[model samples]
Target: MDDASSQSRPSADQPNPFSAVPIEITISVGKARPLIRDLLKLGKDAVLPLDKRVDDAVELYVGERLIARGELEELEGDQQGQLAVRLTEVADLQDGLG
Candidate 1:
């Protein structure tokens, strides 16, 4: 390899950059805010209501920034019953992770 090309490449000791790194994508189904008294009064099998319904689109976030919106779905096949999101509205990031 030429010296110029070798110099431009990342060394083995250096990190692989964000391309190979993993970032946690948080999926927010809904939010529920209960009073402190009501929060503490919860018991086993008790249900706390959320702002959204079962048919509502869930929000995806990377950190605090909202990334995309999608509907909740159950997987088929061996992964059946596993919950997933089908993105309906994705943000225009323009190369940004957020």
Candidate 2:
């Protein structure tokens, strides 16, 4: 009898069945550090300064592992004004995610 939970995965030579699986990619533009006293004094509109400038390439990560670096861009046409990433550097996945 075929066990539903024991189905075999596709061989390496076959098409990857998990290709459509979704993953969360985090974008790290920069970080800010503020004193606890200053943090407590925040009001309606607060602008925390980041270490990087607007043109700096942002780092992409899967969990804590850095995966790639890319520049921030705006979408055009139907997706106008939406944010997107233009990958500048990609990690060697064979080595690892970082």
Candidate 3:
């Protein structure tokens, strides 16, 4: 067998489709409202309210782009639960953007 032929083809021992893509899993996204410097003077237990309302759907972002919006839900036995995003709207938006 020639050196060129052996070099051009992959070996049998090599793994199939040998590449992995990295993905991030976001747990929760709430509107962040930073307290003013003067407000910090109040010290601990001082309530700094978030900009978003409880009924409002929280926006999910991947990198810098908006991905979806979901309502927060509590799972049984698990205090830290999942967000149920509206799939149809998200898919449509993603398709349109793409």
Candidate 4:
């Protein structure tokens, strides 16, 4: 006999209802910590140094969780070029969510 409750519950192969929900994905280029005094001294063209080099892979995050690594790219089109990240390495699902 088939179980009615089993049919109502989501199967392992089935897509989750939350999957359709929107999530904010962020690509972290780098990080910096400036003191209040230093931040206040910033000029119009002030440049703050980051921990990462230009060639370093950028971190992709979903909320606070690290998801993937990618390289920065420029989308060619209009007068103002749009910046984007090209995925290089994907995180393993078992490690977390890929």
Best by lDDT: 2
Worst 10 residues of 3 by lDDT: 88-97
| Angstrom error at residue 21, model 2 | 0.6
Query: Residue 31 of candidate 2: its Cα lDDT?
Result: 96
lDDT of 1 by residue, 1-98 (tens): 56897776778888657668889999998999999999999999999999999899899999988889999999999999999999998988765334
Q: Of 2 and 4, which scores higher on TM-score?
A: 2
Error of 1 at 57 (Å): 0.3
- Which window of 10 residues has the lowest lDDT sum in candidate 2? 3-12
Judge candidate 1 at residue 34 and give its lDDT: 99
Say which prediction, candidate 3 or candidate 4, comes out ahead on lDDT.
4
Error of 1 at 9 (Å): 10
RMSD per model, one decimal: 5.1, 4.1, 6.9, 3.5
Best by TM-score: 2
Which candidate do you rate higher for TM-score, 1 or 4?
A: 1
Order the candidates by lDDT, highest first — what do you get? Answer: 2, 1, 4, 3
* Local accuracy by lDDT, each model: 0.89, 0.91, 0.59, 0.88
Best-to-worst ranking by TM-score: 2, 1, 4, 3
Give per-residue CA lDDT, model 3, range 27-66, as digits (tens).
3456555756756666688666677778677666666666
